[model samples]
Target: MVFEAILYIAVLLISAKLLGELLYRINQPRIIGNVLAGIIVGPALFFLVQPIDAIELFISIGVFFLFFLIGLEEIDLPGLVRVMRGRIFAGSLAGFFIPFFAASFFGLSLDMNFIQAFAIGSVIGASSLGVAAKVLTDLGKLRSTIGLEIFTVTAIIEFIAIILTSVLIQINTSDAPNVSEFLWLFAKMGIFFAVAGLLAVFALPKVFRIIHSHLRAQQVYFGLVIGVILLVAYFAEISGIHGAIGALLLGIAVSRMNREEYLEISKNVNAVGYGIFIPMFFAGIGLHFTTKFVEIDLWIIAGFIGIIVGVKFIGSYIAVKIAKMRPATTVAYGVMSKGAVDLALMLSLLQVNMLDDSLFSLLVLGTLITMIISSVELQRKLKKIVQVKVGSVEIGMLPIFFRRTVSDKRAQDAMSIDFQKTKPNVSVKNFLNSDIDPKEETMVIDDDGRLIGIVSKKELNNVHKKSRDVALISDIMEKKFHTVIPQDYIFSVIQKMNSHHFEMIPVIEPGFSGKIVGIVSSKTLLNLLAETKPPNPSTKS
Candidate 1:
C-alpha cells in the first residue's frame, strides 16, 4: 500500500507539473492544468491513480497549507475589517448571494432535496481566492485598489460559504435535525472562534516572542510553526468548524505580529506548502471527476453551467455598478473565477457521501469552465483601456491615437538599468556620504539582490544626526512603492505613475523574485508619449 501510494503521488505530481506548465503557456490558470492532471490519471482516463487513504491524507494537508498561505500572504486583516462596512461590504453580499440563491433554486427545479440543493448553492456561492489572486497578479493589479476590493469581497463570500457549509455538514451527517443538536453545533462553533480569538489576542504573541528570542535555528522554528498550525487545525475539526478555517485563522494571527519574522516564516511555508501539498489537493479534485456529463440531461447541464456563470457575472456587475467602481465587468469576471475553497468543500462532501458522483462532476466541470473563462475575459478587459476608476480618481480611456504606440510597448524598452541602488544593511549615514545628490532616489536591495524598498538622500538627511549612524537603509527606506515587470505594458506603467504621482517605478524581474532589473522614470515615459503626440493642426506635416 505504501509503495502504491508513492507511485500514485509520483504520477500525479509529474502530470500536474507538465500539464500546469502547458496551461500556463496559454495564459490559463495552472489550476486547470492541475485538475486536468488528475482526470488524466484517475479513473476518467488511464486509471493510473485512485482515491486511496494516503492520497486523501495528503490532499487534506494540501488544503490546510493552501488556506494557511493565503491568509499569511494575501489577506490584510486590518484592511479587510476596514472595508467590510462600506460599499465593499454591499458588493460582497451581492456577489455571494445572487449565485447562491440562483444555484439553489436551479437544484430545487431538478427536484433535488433541500440538503442537496443547499449543497449546490454552497458550492456555487463561494468564489475562489486562489483563482482571483492569480488573475489579479497576472494583470499586475494585485496591489491596486481594485484588487483590494476584489479580495475583500472574495474573503467575505468564502467566510459566509464556510459558515453555511458547517451547517450543511451537521445537518447532512446527523440523524434528523434536532433543535438541541443544532444549538450545540452553533455553540461549539462560537466557542471555537472565541478560543481562537483569545489565543490571537493574548497567547500567540507571547509564544511567538519566546520562539524568536530563544529559537535561532530556522529548522526548529519551521517545525514549531507547522506543529502549531496542525494543532489548530485539529482543534477546528473537533470543534465542528473546519481544519482549513483553523489554519487560516492561525495564519492571519501570525501575520498580524512582527512582519520581518512573518516574512521569513511565510517564505519557508510557501516552499513546503506549494512544493508538495497544494498541487496534490488540486489533483484530488480530478480524482473524483468523471467524464460522465452525458449521463445528465443536456438541458440540465446547460442550465447548471449557465446559472453558475451568468448569475455570478450579473450579480457582481450590478454590485460594482451600484458601488461606483468602474469597469464592473472586469470585477465581475474576477469573482467568477472559482476554485480552492469551493473545491475543498466539494471534496469534503464527496468523501462523506453527501455529494454524489454526478453532482460532483457537474460542479467541478462548471468550476473549471468558470476559471478558464474568468482568466481570458479579465485579461482581455484589463488589456484594453475603456477607463478605470481607482479610489476617487477616474482614468479616462486611452486615446485612440496612442493606442497602437503605447499599448504594444513594454516597460523594459524604456527602463534604465544604470539607476543607483544600495544594500539594505548599509547605514543611512554612509549612503548619504556618497556622491548621490540630495534629491536622488536609491533602490534598496537584499543580499539576493531582491528590491526591498526605496530611499532618498533627502529623507536620510532629515534623520537625527545621532541616530543616522545606527539606522540602516532598511529602517529609513519607504516600503510602500509600486513596481512593474519587464513585460508590463508601457501604457499601464504610465497609468500607474500618473495615478500615484510617482516620479519613477522600479522594474522587477519576472516570476515575483522582486529583483531590481531596471527602473522606468516618468520623464522617459513622457518622452514616449510626446514622440507619439500627433502634429498640431496648425503645424504643417
Candidate 2:
C-alpha cells in the first residue's frame, strides 16, 4: 500500500509536469494543466490511482501551506477592509446560502438525509484559491475590478465553509444537542480569532522582526517558520478547527510585520511553494479519483457536479456584476476555475465520509472542465487591458511603465554636446584633473571610436585610487544610457531624473548607431521651461 501511494504521487506529478509544459506553450497557465492532470489521472479515465486516507492528508497539508502563503501575500489591510464591506458580504451570503439550500433540496428530493444534503452543499460552495489565483494570473487580471470582486466574494465564502463545517461537526457529534454543548464549538472559534487577532496586533510583529533580522541563513529560517506553521496547524486541530485555519492565522499575523522584510521573506516562501509543495499538492488530488465510482447513477453524479460547477458560474457572475466589475462576464469566467483547494475540500469531505466516492469524483471532474474554459476566457480578456492613466496626473506613484522621451532642447543644452561638431580622436582621459581650465572639457571614446561615457573635470578627481587606470570612459563614463527621439518631451526626462536623482543624463541620438549623441541636465530642463513660458510681467525691482 505504501509503495502504491509513492508510485501514485510520482505518476501524478510527472503527468502534471508534462501537461503543465504543454499548457505553457499555448500561453495558458501551468495550473490549468495541473488541475486537468488530476482529472485525467483520476476517475475520468485511469483506475491507476486510488483515494486513500494518507493521500488525502498529504493533500490537506498542501492546502494549509498554500493558504499560509496566500495569507502572507494578502497584507493589504485596506483591501481586506474593502472586501469585508457590506456589498461583498451580502454577495457571499447569497452565494453560500442559496446554493446550499438548493443542494439540500436536491439531496432531500433524492431521499438523502439532512446531513448528506449539507455535505453536498459544502462541496459545491467551496472555491479553490490555487485555481482562482492561476486563472486570474493567466488572465493578467488579478488586480482588475473583476478579480477583486471574485477574490472578495470567494474569500467571504471561505468563512462560510468553516461555519458550515462546524455545524456538521456539531450535528455529527451531538446525540441530543443542548444549547451549552452547541456553544462550545462557537466559543472555541471565537477564542481562536481573539487569540489570533491579539497576536496580530501585538506579539507577532516583534517575533517576525527577530526572525527576519537575526536569521540571516535561509534554510534555518525556512525550517523554523515551517515548524511554526505546522505547530499552529496541529494546535488548530486540537483547538477544534481545521489545521488550515491555524496556518492561515499564522500567516495573517506574520504578514502584518514590516512590509519590506515581509516581502523579502514572501519572495523566498513563494519560490519554495511554487517549486515544491504547490505542484505536489495539485497533482496529488488526481491520485484520489479511482475511476470505479463513475459507475454510479448518471443523474446522481450530474446533480453533484452541477451544484458545484453551476453555482460558481451563477454566483460569480451575479456577485461580480453587483460588485461593479467593468466586464462582469470575463471576471465570472475567471472565477469559475476550480483548484487544488477545491479538490482538497472534496477529499476532506471524502476522507471523513461527508461525501461519497462517486460524488467526490464527479465534483473533481467539474473543477477540471471549468478550469479549461477559465484558461481560454481569462487569456482573451487580459489582452484587452491597456495601461491607462487613472487621473489627469501623468505621474504614477512608482513608475511601472516608462515611455522614454527627452526633448531636444533640454537634451542638447544639458550636455551641450555635438559629437559630429566636436574635435574627434581626442581621449577625454587627458583632462581628468579638476585643476584644468574650466573652458576645456574632456570627451571620451571607446576602442571603436564611438562615445561611450563622459566624465566632467569635477567628476574625474573623485574617482577612487584603486579604480584609477582601468576605469576607462567605459568604466566611469555614466554607464546608464537614456534615449531620445528628435521629438520627445522634457517632463519625461524629469521623471527619469526623479527616479535616479540624475543631475545630468546621456542622450542617444535618434536612429543613430552611435554612443550618446548628446546629454541633458536638470538646469537645461528648467531653462527650456523658462524659455517656453511667457515672460514675467513685473521685472527686477
Candidate 3:
C-alpha cells in the first residue's frame, strides 16, 4: 500500500508539473493543466488512479493551505474595513444575488427540490477567492484599489457562503428542520467568529512574537504555523463552520504582524504550498471526474454555465456602475472568475446526497469551463491596455504607454556606468566619509566582487547614532533588497521601483554570481524619457 501510494503521488506530481508548464507556455492558466492532469490520470482516461483515502487526506490539507495562503496574501482586516465602504457592499450584493437566484430558478425548472435548488444556487453564487486572486496577481493589480475591492467583496461572499453551506448541511441531515435548529446554527456561527476574532486580536500576536524570539530554524517555525492552522480548523469545524474558514481567519491574523516577520513566514509557507500540497489539491479535483454518473443533459449544463458567467458579469457591472465606480470591466472579470469555493460546496452537497452524480458532474464541469473562459477573457482584455516583456519573460500586464524612448528600453541600456560600490567589511564611518551621496543608495560587494547587499544613508546614520561600538557596512546593509539584471526590461524595473518606492535600483549581471554592473535612478530614467522621441509601433525595434 505504501509503495502504491508513493507511486501514485509521483505520477500526480510529475504529470501536474509538466502539464502546468505547458499551459503556462501557451499563456493559459496553469491550474487548467493541473486539473487536466488529474482528469487524465483518474476516471476520465485510463482510470489508472483511484481517489484513495490517503490521497483525499492530502488533498484536504492542500486546500487548507491554499486558502490559508490566499488569506495571508490579500487580507488586512483593518485596512479592508477602512477601504470597504458603500460601493463594496453594493457590488457584493449584486454579484451574489443575481446568479444565485437565477441558478436557483433554473434548478427548480429542472424539477429539483427547494433544498437542492438552493444548494445549486449557492454553489453558483460563491466566488473563488483563489482564482480571482491569481488573476489579479498575474495582472500586477493585487495591491491596487480595484484589487482590494474585489478581494473585499469575495471575502464577504465566502463567509456568507460558508454559513449557508453549514445551514444547508444541517437541514439535509435532519429528518425535521426546525426554526430553533436554524437559530442554533446561526448562534454557533456567531460564537465562532467572536472567539476567533478575540484570539486573533489578542493571543496570536504574542504567540508569533515568542515563536520568532525562541525559534530560529525555518522548519520549526513552519511546523508551528501548520499546528496553529490545524488547531484553528478544528475549532471551526466544532463551531459548525468549514475548516477552510478557520484556516483563512488564522492567515488573516498572521498577515497583520510586522512586515518583515510576515514576509519571512509567508515566503516559507508559499514554498511548501506551491511545491507540493496546492498542486495535489487541484489534481484531486480532477480525480473526481467520472462518466459513470447518470446521464448528463448537455443543454441543462449549457444553461448552467451561461447563467453563471453572464449573470455574474452583468450583476457586478450594474452594481459597480450604480455605485459610480470606475473600471467596471475589471470588476466584472473579477466577479466572473469562480472555482474553488464553488467546487467545495458542490462536493459537500454530493457527500450529503443532496445532489446526485449527474448534477454534481454538471456543476463541476460548468464551474471549470466558466473559470477558464473568464481567465482567458480577462487576460485578453488586459493585454490591450498594457503589455510588459523582459526578453522572453513577460512580467504580467503593465500600464499602456503611448510612445517609446531610451528610458522605455532595457535597464542595461540606460543605467549609469559610474555608481558607488564598497566592500562589505568597510566601516560605516569610513563609508560615510567617502564621496558617495548621503541621500542615495550604496551597493555592498564581497571579496570576490559579487553584489552582496545595499545600504542607504539613513540606515548608516541610524547605525552610527544607535551603536556605541563601530560596525561594518554589512552590519547596517539590507541583504534582502530587490535586484535587477541587465537583460531586464526598464518597464519591469520601473514597476518594481514604483511599487517599492525606491529612488534608485542596482543593476547586476545575469547568472548565479550577480556582479554589480551599474545603477539606474529615477532622474536618469526621466532624462532619457525626455531626450528620446516616440517610435512608430510597427517599425520600432
Candidate 4:
C-alpha cells in the first residue's frame, strides 16, 4: 500500500512538473497544466491512478499549506479589514447572492426540495479564494488595489457560503428547522475568531520571536510553524469552520513579524509549498474528475453554466462599476473562476442520495470548464490593462497593470549618468575629501564598473574622524542595495525606493553583467513627473 501510494505521487509530481513548465513557457497559467496533469493520469483517462485515503490525506495537507502561504505572502490582513466596508463589501454582497439565488431558483424550477436547492445555491454562490489568490500571485498583483478588493470580496463570499451551507445541512438532516444548531455554529465561529484574535495579538508574536532568537535549528522552527498551523486548523474544524480559514488566520498573524524574520521563514515555507503541496492540491482537484459526463443531459448543464456565469459577471460588473474600479471586466472574470469546493459539496449530496449521479457529473463538469475559462480570460485581460494615472498621490498604489502601458517611461530615461562614483578600495578619508555631493549617494564600483555597494556622505560623517583614514570605502559602504534595469518603468523605480526608503538607486545594464550605467534619484524622478511636457515614450536617456 505504501509503495503504491509513493508510485502514484511520483507519477503525479513528474507529470505536473512537465506540463507546468510547458504552460509557463507559453505564458499561460501553470496551474492549468497542474490540473491537466491530474486529469490525464487519474481515472478520468488512464485509470492508472485513483483517489485513495492516503492521497486524499496528502491533498488535504496541501490545501492547508496552500491557503496559509497565500495569507502570509499575498494578503495584508489589517489593510484588508480596513477596506472591507466600502465597495469591497458591496461587491461581495452582490456577487455572493446573485449566483446563489439564481442557482437555487434554477434548482427549484427543476422541482428539487428547498433544502437541496439551497445547498446547490451555496456551492455556486461561493467564489474560490484559492483561485483568486493563485491568479493574482502568478501575475504579481496580489498586493495591488484590485487584488486586495478581490481577496476581500472573495473571502467574504466564501465565508458566508460556508456558514449558510453548514446551517442548511443541519436543517436538512433534522425532523425540524434547528434554530439552536444555527446559533451554536454561529457562536462557535465567533468564539473561534475571538480566540484567534487573542492568539494573534498576544501569543504568536512572543512565541515565534523567542524561537527565532533562541533557536539555531531551521528544522525545529519549521516543525513548530507546521505544528501551530495544524493546531489552529484542528480548532477551526471543531468550531464549525473550514481548516483553511484557520491556517490563513495563522498565516496573517505570523506575517506581522519583522520583515527579515518573515522572509527567512517564508523562504523555507515557500520551497516546501510550491515544490510539493500546492501542486498536489491542484492535481487532487483533477483526480476528482471521473469520466461520467456521457450520462448527463448536455442542455441542462449548458443552461446551468450559462445562468451562473452570466449572473456572476453582471453582478460583479455592476458592483465594480458603481465602485468606480477600472477594468471591471477583469474583476468579473476573476470572480467567475470556480474550484473543487462545489464538486466536494455535490459528491457529499450524491452519497446521501440527495442528488443523482447525472446531476453530480453535470455540476462537476461545469465547474471544471469555468475554472479553465476564467483563468485564461483573467490572464489575457491582465496583459492588456493600460496604465493611466489615478491621482498624483494615489498613483503609487495603482495595480501592476499600470506599469504595462507602452507610454510609461523606463529607468534609462530618468537616470543621470553624471552622479558621483568611487572605487571599493578607496580610503574613506580620500572619498570624503573628494568633490562629492553630501546629498547624493556615492556609488561604489569594482574594477569592471559593476555596482558593488554605496557610500552615503551621512554614513561617513557618523564614523569618528580617527577611524576615517584607517577604514576603506568597502568597509563603510552598504553592500545590500536595490537596482533597476535600464528598461524598467520609472513607477517601478519609485515603488522600490518607497519600499526600501532609498533616496537614489543605481541603474545597471540588464542580464548577468550588472554594469553601472547611471543613477536615478528621488528628486530627479519627482522633477520629471512635475514637468509640463508630455514624455516621449520612444526616448531613452
Give the winner by TM-score: 1
lDDT (tens digit, per residue) of candidate 2 on 1-541: 8888888777776777888889878866676676667667775567566556665666666777876876676434456576675676666666666667777788888887777678767656655455566666765657754566667766666646655764675455556767786688778878987887687659767776677678778688777767777788888878877777677777777787777867866777777676656766776666555566679788877776676667667876776656544355666665555665556566666766766666666767776776666667666665653322211111111121122222233445445464221222333344353244554334334435445554554465577656655454444555444445334565565655555533555566666566555655554554444334222459653
TM-score of candidate 2 against the unseen true structure: 0.64
lDDT of each: 0.78, 0.62, 0.72, 0.71
Clashing pairs in 3: none
Q: Estimate each model's TM-score.
A: 0.72, 0.64, 0.68, 0.66
lDDT at 426, model 2: 38
* Ten contiguous residues with the weakest lDDT in model 4: 389-398
In model 2, what lDDT does residue 106 have?
A: 83
Candidate number that wins on lDDT, 2 or 3: 3
Model 1 is weakest, by summed lDDT over 10 consecutive residues, at 388-397
Compute the lDDT for candidate 3.
Answer: 0.72
Q: Candidate 1 has which clashing residue pairs, if any?
A: none
**Candidate 3 per-residue lDDT over residues 161-228, each given as its tens digit:** 65576677767676776788778877877888788978976898888878878887868877887788
Q: Rank by lDDT, highest first.
A: 1, 3, 4, 2
Between candidates 2 and 4, name the one with more favorable lDDT: 4
C-alpha RMSD in Å of predicted model 1 compared with the true structure: 13.0
Ranking by TM-score: 1, 3, 4, 2
Model 4 TM-score relative to the real fold: 0.66
Q: Please give the distance, in angstroms, between residue 394's alpha carbon in candidate 3 and its true position after superposition.
A: 24
